[model samples]
Target: MRIRLQRDIDRLKKQVVSLATLVEERFRLAIRAVECRDADLARKVIIGDAEIDQKEVDIEEECLKILALHQPVADHLRYIISVLKLNNDLERIGDLAVNIAQKAEVVASKLELPIPFDYVTMSQRAGEMLEESLNSLVNLDLHLAYRVCAQDDEVDFMKSAMQLQFAEEIRKAKEEHIEPLIHLFLISRHLERIADHATNIAEDVIYMITGEIHRHKGFEYHHSEE
Candidate 1:
Protein backbone atom coordinates (compact mmCIF):
# COMPACT_ATOMS: atom_id res chain seq x y z
CA MET A 1 0.00 0.00 0.00
CA ARG A 2 2.78 2.41 0.85
CA ILE A 3 4.56 1.74 -2.42
CA ARG A 4 1.36 2.21 -4.33
CA LEU A 5 0.75 5.48 -2.57
CA GLN A 6 4.24 6.67 -3.39
CA ARG A 7 3.68 5.79 -7.02
CA ASP A 8 0.52 7.79 -7.06
CA ILE A 9 2.36 10.75 -5.56
CA ASP A 10 5.04 10.47 -8.18
CA ARG A 11 2.45 10.39 -10.91
CA LEU A 12 0.75 13.48 -9.60
CA LYS A 13 4.05 15.31 -9.40
CA LYS A 14 4.72 14.48 -13.04
CA GLN A 15 1.29 15.76 -13.97
CA VAL A 16 1.87 19.06 -12.21
CA VAL A 17 5.28 19.47 -13.78
CA SER A 18 3.80 18.82 -17.21
CA LEU A 19 1.20 21.49 -16.57
CA ALA A 20 3.92 23.89 -15.46
CA THR A 21 5.91 23.30 -18.64
CA LEU A 22 2.90 24.02 -20.83
CA VAL A 23 2.06 27.17 -18.92
CA GLU A 24 5.66 28.32 -19.11
CA GLU A 25 5.59 27.90 -22.88
CA ARG A 26 2.44 29.98 -23.05
CA PHE A 27 4.11 32.73 -21.07
CA ARG A 28 7.12 32.64 -23.38
CA LEU A 29 4.96 32.94 -26.46
CA ALA A 30 3.01 35.81 -24.98
CA ILE A 31 6.20 37.71 -24.38
CA ARG A 32 7.41 36.91 -27.85
CA ALA A 33 4.20 38.21 -29.35
CA VAL A 34 4.62 41.44 -27.44
CA GLU A 35 8.19 41.88 -28.59
CA CYS A 36 7.56 41.12 -32.26
CA ARG A 37 3.98 42.37 -32.37
CA ASP A 38 2.90 38.99 -33.69
CA ALA A 39 -0.83 38.87 -33.44
CA ASP A 40 -1.05 35.28 -34.64
CA LEU A 41 1.26 34.00 -31.91
CA ALA A 42 -0.75 35.87 -29.32
CA ARG A 43 -3.93 34.29 -30.63
CA LYS A 44 -2.33 30.85 -30.41
CA VAL A 45 -1.38 31.47 -26.79
CA ILE A 46 -4.95 32.45 -25.96
CA ILE A 47 -6.29 29.34 -27.60
CA GLY A 48 -3.78 27.15 -25.74
CA ASP A 49 -5.15 28.34 -22.39
CA ALA A 50 -7.96 25.83 -22.71
CA GLU A 51 -5.41 23.02 -22.67
CA ILE A 52 -3.88 24.27 -19.46
CA ASP A 53 -7.28 24.48 -17.83
CA GLN A 54 -8.11 20.93 -18.84
CA LYS A 55 -4.78 19.64 -17.56
CA GLU A 56 -5.31 21.36 -14.22
CA VAL A 57 -8.66 19.69 -13.81
CA ASP A 58 -7.17 16.35 -14.68
CA ILE A 59 -4.43 16.79 -12.10
CA GLU A 60 -6.99 17.69 -9.46
CA GLU A 61 -9.00 14.59 -10.27
CA GLU A 62 -5.90 12.44 -9.90
CA CYS A 63 -5.15 13.98 -6.53
CA LEU A 64 -8.69 13.34 -5.38
CA LYS A 65 -8.55 9.74 -6.46
CA ILE A 66 -5.28 9.15 -4.62
CA LEU A 67 -6.64 10.73 -1.48
CA ALA A 68 -9.71 8.55 -1.60
CA LEU A 69 -7.92 5.32 -2.32
CA HIS A 70 -4.73 5.74 -0.32
CA GLN A 71 -5.70 8.05 2.49
CA PRO A 72 -2.09 9.14 2.81
CA VAL A 73 -0.99 10.29 6.25
CA ALA A 74 1.42 12.78 7.73
CA ASP A 75 3.86 14.25 5.22
CA HIS A 76 2.33 12.42 2.31
CA LEU A 77 -1.06 13.93 2.98
CA ARG A 78 0.48 17.39 3.25
CA TYR A 79 2.32 16.99 -0.04
CA ILE A 80 -0.81 15.94 -1.90
CA ILE A 81 -2.79 18.83 -0.47
CA SER A 82 -0.03 21.22 -1.37
CA VAL A 83 0.04 19.93 -4.93
CA LEU A 84 -3.69 20.45 -5.20
CA LYS A 85 -3.36 24.07 -4.09
CA LEU A 86 -0.30 24.69 -6.23
CA ASN A 87 -2.13 23.25 -9.20
CA ASN A 88 -4.74 25.96 -8.82
CA ASP A 89 -2.06 28.62 -8.70
CA LEU A 90 -0.45 27.26 -11.85
CA GLU A 91 -3.79 27.33 -13.64
CA ARG A 92 -4.29 30.94 -12.69
CA ILE A 93 -0.83 31.80 -13.96
CA GLY A 94 -1.76 30.30 -17.30
CA ASP A 95 -4.86 32.45 -17.38
CA LEU A 96 -2.76 35.53 -16.72
CA ALA A 97 -0.45 34.64 -19.58
CA VAL A 98 -3.43 34.25 -21.85
CA ASN A 99 -4.72 37.60 -20.72
CA ILE A 100 -1.43 39.19 -21.65
CA ALA A 101 -1.60 37.53 -25.03
CA GLN A 102 -5.06 38.97 -25.55
CA LYS A 103 -3.76 42.43 -24.73
CA ALA A 104 -0.98 41.97 -27.25
CA GLU A 105 -3.53 40.88 -29.82
CA VAL A 106 -5.51 44.05 -29.28
CA VAL A 107 -2.47 46.27 -29.70
CA ALA A 108 -0.99 44.45 -32.66
CA SER A 109 -3.03 46.42 -35.17
CA LYS A 110 -1.50 49.68 -34.02
CA LEU A 111 1.99 51.03 -34.55
CA GLU A 112 4.48 49.71 -32.02
CA LEU A 113 5.55 52.20 -29.36
CA PRO A 114 9.08 52.87 -28.10
CA ILE A 115 8.87 51.80 -24.49
CA PRO A 116 11.83 51.72 -22.06
CA PHE A 117 11.00 48.44 -20.41
CA ASP A 118 11.41 44.99 -21.95
CA TYR A 119 8.63 42.44 -21.68
CA VAL A 120 11.29 39.73 -22.03
CA THR A 121 12.84 40.54 -18.67
CA MET A 122 9.57 40.49 -16.80
CA SER A 123 8.46 37.30 -18.51
CA GLN A 124 11.82 35.66 -17.85
CA ARG A 125 11.66 36.43 -14.15
CA ALA A 126 8.16 35.00 -13.87
CA GLY A 127 9.31 31.90 -15.73
CA GLU A 128 12.30 31.52 -13.43
CA MET A 129 10.04 31.75 -10.41
CA LEU A 130 7.75 29.07 -11.78
CA GLU A 131 10.68 26.78 -12.57
CA GLU A 132 12.28 27.28 -9.17
CA SER A 133 9.03 26.74 -7.33
CA LEU A 134 8.44 23.46 -9.12
CA ASN A 135 12.02 22.41 -8.47
CA SER A 136 11.58 23.16 -4.78
CA LEU A 137 8.45 21.05 -4.73
CA VAL A 138 10.10 18.07 -6.43
CA ASN A 139 13.20 18.27 -4.23
CA LEU A 140 11.49 19.42 -1.01
CA ASP A 141 13.78 22.44 -0.83
CA LEU A 142 12.26 25.03 1.46
CA HIS A 143 15.16 27.42 0.98
CA LEU A 144 14.74 27.44 -2.80
CA ALA A 145 11.02 27.99 -2.41
CA TYR A 146 11.69 30.96 -0.14
CA ARG A 147 14.11 32.38 -2.68
CA VAL A 148 11.49 32.02 -5.40
CA CYS A 149 9.01 33.81 -3.16
CA ALA A 150 11.45 36.66 -2.62
CA GLN A 151 11.94 37.15 -6.38
CA ASP A 152 8.23 37.81 -6.74
CA ASP A 153 8.79 41.30 -5.39
CA GLU A 154 11.51 41.92 -7.93
CA VAL A 155 9.09 40.97 -10.66
CA ASP A 156 6.50 43.24 -9.09
CA PHE A 157 8.94 46.16 -9.00
CA MET A 158 9.86 45.67 -12.64
CA LYS A 159 6.18 45.55 -13.57
CA SER A 160 5.48 48.83 -11.77
CA ALA A 161 8.46 50.48 -13.39
CA MET A 162 7.20 49.33 -16.76
CA GLN A 163 3.77 50.76 -16.06
CA LEU A 164 5.21 54.13 -15.03
CA GLN A 165 7.40 54.25 -18.09
CA PHE A 166 4.46 53.47 -20.35
CA ALA A 167 2.33 56.09 -18.63
CA GLU A 168 4.99 58.69 -19.25
CA GLU A 169 5.31 57.68 -22.86
CA ILE A 170 1.55 57.84 -23.25
CA ARG A 171 1.43 61.36 -21.82
CA LYS A 172 4.10 62.50 -24.27
CA ALA A 173 2.33 61.09 -27.33
CA LYS A 174 -1.26 60.54 -26.37
CA GLU A 175 -2.87 60.28 -29.79
CA GLU A 176 -0.02 58.56 -31.57
CA HIS A 177 0.64 55.86 -28.94
CA ILE A 178 -2.59 55.48 -27.02
CA GLU A 179 -3.39 51.96 -28.21
CA PRO A 180 0.03 50.52 -27.47
CA LEU A 181 0.13 52.33 -24.15
CA ILE A 182 -3.12 50.77 -23.04
CA HIS A 183 -1.95 47.35 -24.15
CA LEU A 184 1.39 47.79 -22.40
CA PHE A 185 -0.34 48.65 -19.14
CA LEU A 186 -2.61 45.63 -19.47
CA ILE A 187 0.30 43.33 -20.24
CA SER A 188 2.28 44.61 -17.26
CA ARG A 189 -0.72 44.05 -15.03
CA HIS A 190 -0.99 40.49 -16.25
CA LEU A 191 2.70 39.88 -15.57
CA GLU A 192 2.29 41.22 -12.05
CA ARG A 193 -0.57 38.85 -11.43
CA ILE A 194 1.48 35.98 -12.82
CA ALA A 195 4.24 36.76 -10.37
CA ASP A 196 1.70 36.79 -7.57
CA HIS A 197 0.49 33.34 -8.54
CA ALA A 198 4.08 32.08 -8.63
CA THR A 199 4.61 33.51 -5.16
CA ASN A 200 1.50 31.75 -3.94
CA ILE A 201 2.81 28.44 -5.25
CA ALA A 202 6.19 29.05 -3.64
CA GLU A 203 4.51 29.74 -0.33
CA ASP A 204 2.55 26.54 -0.65
CA VAL A 205 5.79 24.64 -1.23
CA ILE A 206 7.28 26.24 1.87
CA TYR A 207 4.20 25.24 3.83
CA MET A 208 4.39 21.71 2.51
CA ILE A 209 7.93 21.48 3.76
CA THR A 210 7.50 23.29 7.10
CA GLY A 211 3.90 22.51 8.00
CA GLU A 212 3.33 26.19 8.85
CA ILE A 213 0.80 28.50 7.21
CA HIS A 214 2.24 31.66 5.64
CA ARG A 215 -0.60 32.73 3.43
CA HIS A 216 -1.75 36.19 4.53
CA LYS A 217 1.08 37.24 6.82
CA GLY A 218 3.65 39.69 5.54
CA PHE A 219 6.89 38.07 4.41
CA GLU A 220 9.91 40.18 3.58
CA TYR A 221 11.07 39.94 -0.04
CA HIS A 222 14.84 39.87 -0.16
CA HIS A 223 16.59 41.35 -3.18
CA SER A 224 20.10 40.78 -4.40
CA GLU A 225 22.23 43.86 -5.00
CA GLU A 226 22.88 44.55 -8.64
Candidate 2:
Protein backbone atom coordinates (compact mmCIF):
# COMPACT_ATOMS: atom_id res chain seq x y z
CA MET A 1 0.00 0.00 0.00
CA ARG A 2 2.81 2.38 0.89
CA ILE A 3 4.68 1.77 -2.34
CA ARG A 4 1.54 2.15 -4.40
CA LEU A 5 0.70 5.36 -2.64
CA GLN A 6 4.17 6.75 -3.33
CA ARG A 7 3.82 5.77 -6.97
CA ASP A 8 0.52 7.60 -7.21
CA ILE A 9 2.11 10.63 -5.60
CA ASP A 10 4.97 10.52 -8.09
CA ARG A 11 2.53 10.31 -10.97
CA LEU A 12 0.61 13.28 -9.58
CA LYS A 13 3.77 15.33 -9.43
CA LYS A 14 4.56 14.53 -13.05
CA GLN A 15 1.06 15.49 -14.13
CA VAL A 16 1.21 18.79 -12.28
CA VAL A 17 4.65 19.57 -13.66
CA SER A 18 3.49 18.77 -17.18
CA LEU A 19 0.51 21.04 -16.76
CA ALA A 20 2.77 23.79 -15.50
CA THR A 21 5.00 23.44 -18.52
CA LEU A 22 2.06 23.69 -20.92
CA VAL A 23 0.68 26.71 -19.12
CA GLU A 24 4.06 28.42 -19.16
CA GLU A 25 4.39 27.87 -22.87
CA ARG A 26 0.93 29.25 -23.42
CA PHE A 27 1.83 32.28 -21.35
CA ARG A 28 4.95 32.91 -23.35
CA LEU A 29 2.99 32.62 -26.58
CA ALA A 30 0.47 35.10 -25.28
CA ILE A 31 3.24 37.53 -24.45
CA ARG A 32 4.72 37.07 -27.87
CA ALA A 33 1.35 37.60 -29.49
CA VAL A 34 1.05 40.91 -27.69
CA GLU A 35 4.55 41.97 -28.68
CA CYS A 36 4.23 40.98 -32.31
CA ARG A 37 0.53 41.67 -32.77
CA ASP A 38 -0.02 38.16 -34.01
CA ALA A 39 -3.69 37.42 -34.17
CA ASP A 40 -3.21 33.81 -35.27
CA LEU A 41 -0.93 33.01 -32.35
CA ALA A 42 -3.33 34.71 -29.96
CA ARG A 43 -6.13 32.59 -31.39
CA LYS A 44 -4.06 29.48 -30.81
CA VAL A 45 -3.55 30.37 -27.18
CA ILE A 46 -7.23 31.11 -26.74
CA ILE A 47 -8.24 27.82 -28.31
CA GLY A 48 -5.72 25.85 -26.27
CA ASP A 49 -7.40 26.91 -23.02
CA ALA A 50 -9.73 23.92 -23.17
CA GLU A 51 -6.81 21.53 -22.94
CA ILE A 52 -5.55 23.30 -19.83
CA ASP A 53 -8.97 23.14 -18.25
CA GLN A 54 -9.20 19.43 -18.91
CA LYS A 55 -5.78 18.78 -17.44
CA GLU A 56 -6.69 20.71 -14.29
CA VAL A 57 -9.83 18.67 -13.83
CA ASP A 58 -7.96 15.43 -14.38
CA ILE A 59 -5.33 16.36 -11.79
CA GLU A 60 -7.97 17.30 -9.25
CA GLU A 61 -9.71 13.96 -9.74
CA GLU A 62 -6.41 12.13 -9.33
CA CYS A 63 -5.71 13.96 -6.08
CA LEU A 64 -9.15 13.09 -4.80
CA LYS A 65 -8.65 9.46 -5.71
CA ILE A 66 -5.39 9.33 -3.80
CA LEU A 67 -6.98 10.97 -0.80
CA ALA A 68 -9.85 8.51 -0.86
CA LEU A 69 -7.91 5.34 -1.49
CA HIS A 70 -4.55 5.85 0.19
CA GLN A 71 -5.60 8.31 2.88
CA PRO A 72 -2.13 9.80 3.07
CA VAL A 73 -1.08 11.45 6.33
CA ALA A 74 1.26 14.20 7.43
CA ASP A 75 3.71 15.34 4.74
CA HIS A 76 2.23 13.17 2.05
CA LEU A 77 -1.21 14.62 2.59
CA ARG A 78 0.21 18.13 2.58
CA TYR A 79 1.98 17.46 -0.69
CA ILE A 80 -1.22 16.31 -2.35
CA ILE A 81 -3.10 19.32 -1.01
CA SER A 82 -0.43 21.66 -2.27
CA VAL A 83 -0.54 20.11 -5.74
CA LEU A 84 -4.31 20.54 -5.84
CA LYS A 85 -4.04 24.23 -4.99
CA LEU A 86 -1.15 24.69 -7.34
CA ASN A 87 -3.13 23.03 -10.11
CA ASN A 88 -5.90 25.57 -9.68
CA ASP A 89 -3.40 28.43 -9.71
CA LEU A 90 -1.78 27.14 -12.87
CA GLU A 91 -5.15 26.77 -14.56
CA ARG A 92 -6.09 30.30 -13.60
CA ILE A 93 -2.80 31.53 -14.94
CA GLY A 94 -3.57 29.74 -18.18
CA ASP A 95 -6.91 31.50 -18.32
CA LEU A 96 -5.22 34.82 -17.75
CA ALA A 97 -2.94 34.03 -20.65
CA VAL A 98 -6.01 33.51 -22.76
CA ASN A 99 -7.35 36.84 -21.58
CA ILE A 100 -4.14 38.50 -22.65
CA ALA A 101 -4.33 36.71 -25.96
CA GLN A 102 -7.85 38.00 -26.51
CA LYS A 103 -6.61 41.47 -25.80
CA ALA A 104 -3.79 40.92 -28.23
CA GLU A 105 -6.24 39.80 -30.91
CA VAL A 106 -8.20 42.99 -30.42
CA VAL A 107 -5.07 45.07 -30.54
CA ALA A 108 -4.04 43.30 -33.73
CA SER A 109 -7.22 44.41 -35.46
CA LYS A 110 -6.62 48.06 -34.62
CA LEU A 111 -4.19 50.53 -36.02
CA GLU A 112 -0.85 50.59 -34.31
CA LEU A 113 -0.28 53.38 -31.80
CA PRO A 114 2.81 54.52 -29.99
CA ILE A 115 2.99 52.44 -26.82
CA PRO A 116 4.06 54.69 -23.95
CA PHE A 117 4.69 52.01 -21.32
CA ASP A 118 7.36 49.35 -20.80
CA TYR A 119 5.22 46.30 -21.39
CA VAL A 120 8.13 44.05 -22.37
CA THR A 121 9.88 44.43 -19.06
CA MET A 122 6.67 43.81 -17.16
CA SER A 123 5.90 40.67 -19.13
CA GLN A 124 9.43 39.36 -18.71
CA ARG A 125 9.33 39.78 -14.95
CA ALA A 126 6.01 38.02 -14.68
CA GLY A 127 7.24 35.18 -16.87
CA GLU A 128 10.34 34.80 -14.74
CA MET A 129 8.25 34.68 -11.60
CA LEU A 130 6.08 31.91 -13.03
CA GLU A 131 9.08 29.91 -14.21
CA GLU A 132 10.93 30.31 -10.93
CA SER A 133 7.90 29.41 -8.89
CA LEU A 134 7.56 26.14 -10.79
CA ASN A 135 11.29 25.51 -10.38
CA SER A 136 11.00 26.07 -6.63
CA LEU A 137 8.25 23.52 -6.46
CA VAL A 138 10.20 20.98 -8.51
CA ASN A 139 13.35 21.38 -6.42
CA LEU A 140 11.57 21.82 -3.08
CA ASP A 141 13.85 24.78 -2.45
CA LEU A 142 12.49 26.99 0.32
CA HIS A 143 14.79 29.86 -0.61
CA LEU A 144 13.57 29.87 -4.19
CA ALA A 145 9.99 29.89 -3.01
CA TYR A 146 10.74 32.93 -0.85
CA ARG A 147 12.33 34.66 -3.81
CA VAL A 148 9.24 33.99 -5.95
CA CYS A 149 7.01 35.55 -3.28
CA ALA A 150 9.23 38.62 -3.02
CA GLN A 151 9.11 39.16 -6.81
CA ASP A 152 5.36 39.66 -6.81
CA ASP A 153 5.82 43.13 -5.41
CA GLU A 154 7.77 44.18 -8.47
CA VAL A 155 4.98 43.07 -10.79
CA ASP A 156 2.49 44.90 -8.60
CA PHE A 157 4.59 48.06 -8.79
CA MET A 158 4.70 47.78 -12.57
CA LYS A 159 0.95 47.45 -12.76
CA SER A 160 0.45 50.55 -10.60
CA ALA A 161 2.97 52.52 -12.58
CA MET A 162 1.38 51.44 -15.83
CA GLN A 163 -1.97 52.63 -14.60
CA LEU A 164 -0.58 56.06 -13.85
CA GLN A 165 1.17 56.24 -17.19
CA PHE A 166 -1.98 55.12 -19.02
CA ALA A 167 -3.98 57.84 -17.30
CA GLU A 168 -1.56 60.43 -18.58
CA GLU A 169 -1.42 58.94 -22.08
CA ILE A 170 -5.20 58.77 -22.34
CA ARG A 171 -5.35 62.47 -21.66
CA LYS A 172 -3.27 63.21 -24.77
CA ALA A 173 -4.41 60.43 -27.12
CA LYS A 174 -6.80 60.90 -30.02
CA GLU A 175 -10.18 59.19 -29.82
CA GLU A 176 -9.11 56.53 -32.29
CA HIS A 177 -6.18 55.34 -30.16
CA ILE A 178 -7.93 55.23 -26.80
CA GLU A 179 -9.45 51.75 -27.12
CA PRO A 180 -6.25 50.04 -28.20
CA LEU A 181 -4.36 51.71 -25.38
CA ILE A 182 -6.93 50.42 -22.94
CA HIS A 183 -6.47 46.91 -24.28
CA LEU A 184 -2.73 47.21 -23.88
CA PHE A 185 -3.20 48.33 -20.28
CA LEU A 186 -5.39 45.31 -19.72
CA ILE A 187 -2.64 43.02 -20.97
CA SER A 188 -0.36 44.46 -18.31
CA ARG A 189 -3.05 43.76 -15.75
CA HIS A 190 -3.34 40.16 -16.94
CA LEU A 191 0.40 39.71 -16.65
CA GLU A 192 0.27 41.07 -13.12
CA ARG A 193 -2.46 38.58 -12.31
CA ILE A 194 -0.25 35.76 -13.60
CA ALA A 195 2.46 36.91 -11.22
CA ASP A 196 -0.04 36.85 -8.40
CA HIS A 197 -0.98 33.25 -9.17
CA ALA A 198 2.70 32.35 -9.29
CA THR A 199 3.09 33.85 -5.83
CA ASN A 200 0.21 31.76 -4.55
CA ILE A 201 1.84 28.62 -5.93
CA ALA A 202 5.09 29.56 -4.21
CA GLU A 203 3.28 30.07 -0.92
CA ASP A 204 1.65 26.65 -1.28
CA VAL A 205 5.06 25.08 -1.87
CA ILE A 206 6.34 26.73 1.31
CA TYR A 207 3.41 25.40 3.23
CA MET A 208 3.87 21.91 1.86
CA ILE A 209 7.54 21.76 2.77
CA THR A 210 7.69 23.60 6.08
CA GLY A 211 4.12 23.10 7.29
CA GLU A 212 4.26 26.83 7.88
CA ILE A 213 1.35 28.92 6.72
CA HIS A 214 2.84 32.12 5.35
CA ARG A 215 -0.40 33.53 4.10
CA HIS A 216 -1.31 36.92 5.56
CA LYS A 217 1.98 37.12 7.42
CA GLY A 218 2.28 40.83 6.73
CA PHE A 219 5.73 40.37 5.31
CA GLU A 220 6.11 43.44 3.13
CA TYR A 221 8.80 44.25 0.62
CA HIS A 222 9.78 47.71 -0.58
CA HIS A 223 9.31 48.76 -4.18
CA SER A 224 11.07 51.25 -6.43
CA GLU A 225 10.11 54.91 -6.22
CA GLU A 226 10.44 55.37 -9.95
Best by TM-score: 2
In terms of lDDT, which candidate is strongest?
2
| lDDT tens digits, residue span 6-81, model 2 | 9999999999989999999999999999888899999999999999999999999999999999999999999999
lDDT of each: 0.82, 0.91
Judge candidate 1 against the unseen true structure and give its global Cα lDDT, from 0 to 1: 0.82
The sequence of per-residue lDDT tens digits that candidate 1 reaches over residues 84-157 is 89999889988888888888887777754554567777778877887788778778889998898777768877
RMSD of 2: 2.7
How big is the RMSD of model 1? 3.5
Residue 223 displacement (Å), model 1: 18
TM-score, each model?
Answer: 0.89, 0.95
TM-score of 2: 0.95
Clashing pairs in 2: none
